[model samples]
Target: MVQKDMKLWPFKAIPTADGDNFKKIVIVVTYKGEEKQFALEEISSMLLIKMKQILETYLGSEVKNVVVTIPAYFNDAQRQATKDAGVIAGLNVMRIINEPTAAAIAYCLDRQCTSNGATKNILVFDLGGGTFDVSLVAIKKGVFEVSGDTHLGGRDFDNRLLSHFIAEFERKHNKDISANRRAVGRLRPALDFSCSITRARFEKMNKELFQDCMLPVQMCLRDAKMEKSEIHDVVLVGGSTRIPKIQQLLQEVRDPHVFSLHNIPPAPQGVPQIDVWFNIDIDGILTVSAELVGTNNKNQITITNHSGRLSK
Candidate 1:
């Protein structure tokens, strides 16, 4: 919400369990000479209301049931807060789902994109604006299980950019622009004429942050009892995944060999070479290469799911 030219936003954090998560952020709005306080839940409710209005306009009817997705790392308080937002929005939220789990379900189950009677391990690297999550999910037998991290995300990258830009500005003008909101607004547009940091420059400036992106992924994989090489496919989800640097960091989730299907186990001795090779392309189709044990014969097949979509 805004009054005059000033916008309302969360101004302070309210601690939740473990002091790592926020229960409810404090939203402060200054109107006249007085300040008003609102819970972050209220802000969420307002957003939800607007979203519902948009959906209703499109469908030309009332839509109530909602399956809201939240970060996999949300604590019980945060999850309940989201539900409260739904109630305030006048919508019946049927379920609160982990964002990564929802992404995996949509990518595989809803689309029926899975292999034929075979289980596949998936690494879901979700890099969002505020929070990053790395989920190791196994989809099989009509079930899915996941392990994830909630503390890391694109906000870290954003901070890196801010620091780099601010340093460049300070070096040129010898002034601190942190408190200068108007100047900050012009930072991106004024880039061409200024010392605008390039992607490579930003990556170099914040190398630690770039590498930190993978810590959760490695932890989740260990928890899931899987090796990175065993993952059949890596699904990229969330807006932060759009960054080239982020994409590079997340490619580890993708069977870097998925395109080549080179996770080969040794063949038995005293026998001709037999190879099991499968390549999973961006289209989610898996193509397997099978070499006959004796001669120079090669066999291959394209695997698809019930919906006629390529198995991820």
Candidate 2:
């Protein structure tokens, strides 16, 4: 038996353009599971340092090429920004893969799907901590090809959930949480985390996170037109997916067919409120920049995507 020592770690960062709020950073290590956290100010830098420290402590290997996953809907600037993040982490940029593509790659690696060369058109629905990406991929033998894809992701679900929380909390506490970013910021993770876990056992672990969060979740689940026991085999990709609420919810919503919970949460109609935000005319509801790492690359950065280049 040949001992395989190859390891690949994929990193992802999800930023909300609406409030310039960055939600989480995730790293999928080959055979080592995942490391994730919600990012704070200068988080990209702090995250890079943390990654280096983790690599030093855990792998005892020098950092080499890394695959950074960005949203498919992200423009050149957004992609560039993602690359810059990699550079900061002291990694030799291998390729800037879409979140869905990276996810499919992760799945392939995890499942050992690419031993030889085989081609198959696989549909990948990736709902991350902050964004959602739906992709159609052509895997030939071993070389994976990403065909069509869209960016309708998890953050949208969070926003929807956040809105629901605000409304519900206001009704209960008689105070608007939305207006208070601090409170919303603090409570958002707990509520968001619980909403993902639909498993019954999960309820026992994180009780407080779901105290006032249940009605909103139930309502959102209803609005999504799904019920418990309907979810199964949903690829729960991001940190948020680990939340028992999501797992539980998917169990209810995608019942019968097991939710993968392996890839990003697929854009089931009940999950992302796409129609409300996506304006076909504008190409996307909001624009993201893919930045290149260079000097003076502070806020006023330049990014290039498939569309073109933009100066920020």
Candidate 3:
């Protein structure tokens, strides 16, 4: 069940390598006093089933159809695996959308557009829990054109931190906890044994990883055939974006234009604030409407076409 001699699945291969040429991955687990073998997708399905139950409970309805968001760099096989996981969980996978694309859509829908109706080229820097994606998106007349993607993210930083502390723990206490999962887990919770880390030191430790984040940004600009100055806005998405160093690096890339779209500024006194609302219907059409708080002034745009070719 280990398939130790078989080649590991190449999930990151662009234009994913043909699955037929590789052996399937399986793992053995003891269940009810018996050994059971399960494929990787089956295990993934089990997790998805639990997630579905939670979602159903929250929504108070039986759910079936789902739209899965994946990393922008995911190839056909990876996307198909995601769909299969959903299917195995007893849900119909409606559509697979790129994570960056989805973030860009939400940004466009909620953003306050200039009255001139000029097209804006925005860079989306999405560094989520496990994967990072950078996309150069051109929003014109409710259409989105995307470019660039990446796979590095917050998990790499966590791994680096863990390694640093483990080494420190070994030096101080003369104990090797690297091979001890329980010890490592305890260390992660509190680092209880008189160890400390400063922001500067933490940033220094992961300096290379921080610098690597810029590569995708540069690639996105080149692939889009646009200069850094052309990026009207730099939108940061995901929890990892809150990192000060990450924000600083983004500012260095797009100096004055770097801003978190998630932060809503307070409206000035007596000023009529525009309330923008976004809604995506069942058919994948996005409708954005804006209304003046104290007046009847309103405008709306509906994006019917969600398909676009990413820059190569």
Candidate 4:
């Protein structure tokens, strides 16, 4: 809810469990001239139902099964809650996999590295809109093992921007907009109040956050019992990874093999040979397959639930 523009919402103070066990997130909203309370999972079901409708329309068929990806740090209760959300959405939750793992699968497949008889250690950096995750994955003979996670992401960066601009607006106008939801929402887009933040200033404002991002990378490497040098490729995933400062920071960590499939420059060739496969079905079920490039040894995993989406 912190990530949402409260002004756009028709409700206020949506009650949530903070730092508590994975339980209920109850929200009240005005609907059809009536105020209604809903569990977070039910809200998720409503979104999923809408997504299912869109998917069915696009595919010209009914959709049921799905694979969801959650943050690697999600506890059992959180994972179960995600599956329950899927069930409530009328989807047969096929499997639950880590978000970083899914990104690794997508990366490996995009690079066609699963069929090659080469083993590589990959660092998957996934910084989405609301969460960040770093995974140290060993792609050995087609098997993937993941190792790190975090909760900070683009939303935190957003908060930094929000705080900065709110202070600026107050200084200029001599009025406090901090408590104004509509004011905050207006400030979010382009700072319509004639305020502009340069990239360097933005980076400076979130210097600590950029540094925090690296902590997970280091921890993942340590947890996986590997050195930074052992990582053959650093795969960047999610929208936040496109930020120039993020790219610069990651390049500082692993310059030569940093890769993103989003039209960023391709990694230099002759690095190594490997094979990987990733597929997403009509229902958004994800399947990852991989193998040593020249060997028959292969491994595969299917991911079905994505509860972390709700947390976002």
Candidate 5:
């Protein structure tokens, strides 16, 4: 603080837990950059308390109408849990929008475009930290309508890549990490970092880590049902997607038509266009409160509510 010549730290830390994995993160968005950290604690309650202090200190007052964005595929329990966290912190959450929807809203504002006209279908393919979502929407007269959606996110890919690494590591080092709990825990960060960086540049760091972990990466992409040319553009989103190997994979799939396929589309002349935003770090989930929720993992298209009314 003294060295930086700053008065206050605008960011606060939050603890996140995924399965048995626990991390402490201090997140603060500023004019300079955003900070996401790894917390080194195990207890969930302790993390929550620390987060409350951080929020209070940063805001310098009670929070009002907090906007919590989450995944579209999240169950009711998960959604309620998030809201409960906010309540624990003494905040009234006005609404919880999906991350992608928030990004889209920001994108629209940044581009000076309005969703007020004839219905246009848009496909939001959001790949995030742990999950992925594919949303089809119909925008008309300032309202966004959902047509369809799906989820096959980064977590699945990570698991696939990790499995690949374990197999290769055992074959080469004769050391089975998948069976060793301690080593498996250690291996997670390495694999995530290595795969992430490989998408940007095959630096020495990634090479040293995943030199033998090839088959898994190949298989994961294959499981995605994506080939060199099949994916017109591998819209890079989520922190994992930043890996240089990923970019390479996407590049190899292209037909020397990077511009026509990979590049973001340009805006229309008079009808201003918003840049389709996708986060390459976190998952973007939009919330929809309905009477029904899905209980199965195979999230097939099934509508729960039917009023039996259709109008032209």
Candidate 6:
């Protein structure tokens, strides 16, 4: 993922362009003497020129057109940006597909979930180096609808650790390490190690960011009008989801005890005869309820595969 600082860099606009228009914010670099604005379209064209040359060299044939995919949650801006990238790369953009849609097709979701021709709710969890998002798809009668968070992703997690390391570096040296390229280059070696160390402290320090990972899951369930128990399974995609801290956040999302038990009303006992209680297990699958606690004749009900669904 491109860092936001680099993407929206030193110059916030193109000096030669129309006043206040931000075309150059996408790409501004020093060329020949003055800073020239090369739209991502132009830069992407440049990248394609080189890439096409390499492909022709290796394949001994001309490469003219290509197909591409983007994130499902990507809005119009991101989709347009990618098409621009393809156009500039010097190749005909054949077709653009959403990454999550590609994943569902690859996994044969319909064939897997369509049991007795009944619809099943599927959640696609996509976490990448730069972004994290979740998609809710309901497959029924060979059709589906999709909804999810497009902007969430892996980069936020990395940023948390990176920010931690930056603050630590600043605290130790009493110098801001983000001043300029030269300053950062001078200390890049030490900071690289800090990146590794940040992984160890990730879950410990980045609580809020981790909580974000669950919001999409909640949103998807709401939009789909399905309880968490209705989800047949979760599909984990992207490289960033493998991070231990990221993985742990998913576990917490599935945890039944993720919410406090304080609001739960104790089970009624025959119009106030005795106390009744309910408890959730850590796995969130089975729960045990005691008809009466601290009584020799206590009765309990063991429920297997409890829905574990949170009521709205």
Scanning candidate 2 in windows of ten residues, the lowest lDDT window is 1-10
RMSD of each: 9.2, 22.4, 13.4, 13.4, 19.3, 8.6
- Predictions in order: lDDT: 0.66, 0.45, 0.67, 0.69, 0.43, 0.59
Q: Candidate 4: give its CA RMSD in angstroms.
A: 13.4
Q: What lDDT tens digits, residue by residue, belong to model 6 across residues 121-143?
A: 55677778656667766555322
* Cα lDDT for residue 200, candidate 5: 35
Q: In candidate 6, which residue ranges exceed 4 Å CA deviation?
A: 1-24, 30-36, 43-63, 109-120, 140-151, 185-200, 252-312
Model 3 clashes, total count: 0
lDDT per residue as tens, model 1, 171-274: 88898775654455456345432664565677787788677777777777777676767777677787766555555455546544323433345667855466
lDDT of 3: 0.67
Model 1: residues with Cα > 4 Å off, grouped in runs: 1-24, 31-34, 109-111, 141-149, 180-195, 256-312
- Best-fitting candidate, scored by TM-score: 4
lDDT of 1: 0.66
Regions more than 4 Å wrong, model 5? 1-64, 115-121, 141-151, 191-237, 240-312
Cα lDDT tens digits for candidate 5, 1-312: 122211112233455666778553534333345444523222223445676678779989754556778766567866776777666655676787775566556545654344454443333434555455533333333323221123234444555556666666777788765655446655767742243335434344345333222333344345444343432222333564454344333333333332211223355675432232222332222111221122211111111111101111
Best by lDDT: 4
Candidate 1 clashing pairs, residues 3+ apart or interchain: 132-152, 132-153, 255-258
Return the lDDT, model 4, position 153: 79
Model 4, runs deviating above 4 Å: 1-23, 29-35, 141-150, 189-194, 256-312
Better of 5 and 6 by TM-score: 6
Q: How accurate is candidate 4 locally (lDDT)?
A: 0.69
Model 3: ten consecutive residues of lowest lDDT: 5-14
Error of 5 at 40 (Å): 18
